[model samples]
Target: MRNIFIFIIFISMLFVSLSACQKEDEKLKGLVIESSSVEFGSLQNPEDRELHFRVQINDYGMESEQEYKVRFIIQDAHISDLIATEKIEVPETYKTQLLRNDEARTIVTGGSKEIKKDFTIDEIRKIIEKDEAVIIELYDKNRTIDREVVTTFAENIKPLVKVNPNAKLEHIKLKETNEIDIFSRAISDSNKEQGISYIAYPEYTFSLAEESYFLWVTENNGRIMNTKDTYTIYSLSDSSLKEVKEVIDKK
Candidate 1:
């Protein structure tokens, strides 16, 4: 009788362990990182000498009960072993939200999300080389969701500089049209009011001459709020930007 009882307990424990393993497998299998990379472009620094780069987050993941946090580590990959790196944090949403009154089904085949984080290229120059490999790894706790490696060519690096945010916005019409426009056009916009968040105040900025400008990025009820540079400001004035350009391309 004692032997039979011990065997029964052992069988039950084995079943429980198997079930737990299966659940964890399902959670990991469903989350996919389609691609991870860095984007190079004109940055939003005042001196106009800085280059811009951002980590591109293109991923597919299963819906969860609530918002989850994911991290990206930027590392050097040109050597035999991974070298210098930096960390960036991002918050993501899963499909676990309750459906609306008009909704019918709760099951979704898959969900896709795109995210980006901007950084100045000058900071990481020590680890950069000609055609050097830049590796970006994505993780949730100790589990690695995905990894991407990119080679740099013709990328520039320099000492970081202080962009003049204190440049005053003078409220005066231009006598002669030239470069410095305190308030320029908003290259993009948040279609909905909810997604709008301003990172750079309009009055504190001087126009950067790059073809592509920057803006504060946030989301509203599933809508993304970001703006680019459209045109140049003709004059230097301290006037309220809203009165001049309407949208000052907040970065």
Candidate 2:
């Protein structure tokens, strides 16, 4: 009789442990961030940041009654230490099953309700060290992982020349030196018909040292915003110009 009682007690504890784990399995499976096309080559301010990016999370284990938050983290990839944490409150609507192309999916994908909470260049630079990591995840008070994804953002920011659509040409500046070598593309006869001559700055008034070729652009040439460019820039270091970056006005 005594042995039977002990066996039953052990069996009861095992059942409770298994039940706890099964309940824990009710959380999401994984999270992913939509890719950003933010090319801040010479990005100057946080105002130019891509503030409204989306994050997709698996809702397989969301709690219907409780609220959750997505946390953006930047850390050292190798050291695995937190450098910064930015949290965005998840909407109450996402606390349920995710639906998709006429079928039930398990993902909660959307943007932040508060635009200011979006990550920006200032926040990204905090973790710009070599081999750093950026992580985004969802978590309720008691729920955790599959809730998260680890990744990084843009790096290697360099100064590049730009040609505006309205025929305004601008030079990207280095922290120390504003001078760069400029080269002109051979304008074919076909392109000349489009009034491909470089136009002066329409808004700002500035003095040019002389006929600076690298600083000119074919105004109103229908150039792609980010894919087409008219100048090859070279760094003006120590009285000599060395080709550094080829600037493109990509669409």
Candidate 3:
């Protein structure tokens, strides 16, 4: 008789565990995001630019009363600064089952939502520079599941260049040499319709003897052309411009 009572208790505990497992599966799962085009826009319309995308909520494993708050963001790829954002609320999915003459059919409602946002080229430029990437993401309020795409804003934007603070110019005194703004130079070339391909990347600018020059590192080698002397500077890695500065100091 005691054995029978113990068996009954064990069966009850197993049934309770199974019920708990089933209840845990009632959370919503699938949320997807899709976009028509990754490119923000072209340089043709410099004044106006727009971003378009879509968000989809799948009803396959969605819960009956589950609600989701979705957020869309356009952020800088290098720095996660928010450029633009939009929020949306998705209600619980409604489903209906119909049976007629031994035939059963299920109809699902509430799935996809279209999101369209208008932005300016200036807004994108403020976030990301030329040749740099921008990130567009769609995520739920929980931030657990997200979809993102990385794309460049425009090809015509000037590359971001700044003085290398870590660079040491021991050979030249500070008053004797001036810092050259390579970004402005690239913009000037672009304005002339000559394109900025010449000074796009891996380039260093320095002023020596009141003459500004650019040293371009190509094919693992950098060339600096001057009327006085031409220096062949080899770069071990393109990660830093300090090597270029070191060579200049040595010369």
Candidate 4:
């Protein structure tokens, strides 16, 4: 009888352990590092030379009873040195909330963060020149969820400079125009209110002057956001009409 009882207890414990492992696996499957990018600070300011990078994370799992935390580590891949670290927490109630009434289903979710580090212009240039300039790793505790090795910073790094108010603002106007276009066509009819953002690079004129920038139109519908130069838009369904129009006019 005693032997049978002991076996039963062991079997129950093993079942619980297996269940927990499976739950964790499911949660991880819903999580991802959606996108990452590097932004350079003002080049003319000797005291304010810096590098700012953003990492966007998303969790597509069901609402959790407990809070969870994830981390991102950036390193100089060539030298094996740590550059920066960022942490994001998903609160206990953090999950996509859907509103289903008379209109379309509006899903609301948010998760994004930015890290800034000071580096000299020369140091920054040299660091990015390496074949593998930067290595970004995402961790859920000790387990690595994702790893991205950036070979060249040419496409990722967008240099910033002081704006001359008096100069013609053609590029800024163009970016605003693009945002309005997205707002009118894609966002106006849907359940989402449009919000557009971008990182503008210093315009270069070798052959002919052209507008250069990274634009993102978000309609908050999911947990993940993209922060790269690409034109991938997120469906985040919350924003004010006045705010977007103001941005267009001010630009």
Error of 4 at 206 (Å): 26
TM-score of each: 0.27, 0.33, 0.29, 0.29
Residue clash pairs of candidate 1:
63-95, 169-237, 169-238, 170-237, 170-238, 170-239, 171-238, 171-239
Using lDDT as the measure, the top candidate is 4
lDDT of 2: 0.36
lDDT of 2 by residue, 196-232 (tens): 3333332221123332233223332222111122222
lDDT of 1 at 114: 22
Instruction: Please state the error at residue 186 of candidate 1 in Å.
Output: 39
What C-alpha lDDT do the candidate models reach, one value each?
0.36, 0.36, 0.37, 0.40
* Residue 244 lDDT (model 2): 24
**What residue runs in model 4 are displaced by over 4 Å at the alpha carbon?**
1-31, 42-47, 61-74, 77-130, 150-251
Where does candidate 2 stray beyond 4 Å?
Answer: 1-48, 51-53, 61-67, 76-93, 98-132, 142-145, 152-214, 217-251
Which candidate has the highest TM-score of all? 2
**Steric clash pairs (candidate 3):** none
For residues 42-140, could you state the per-residue lDDT of candidate 1 as single tens digits? 333222322223343423233344333445444544221322224445555333344466232222121112223333343334444434445444455
lDDT string, candidate 3, 136-239, tens digits? 33334555344444343333322222224466433322232222332223222321222222333324554554454444545454433221111112223332
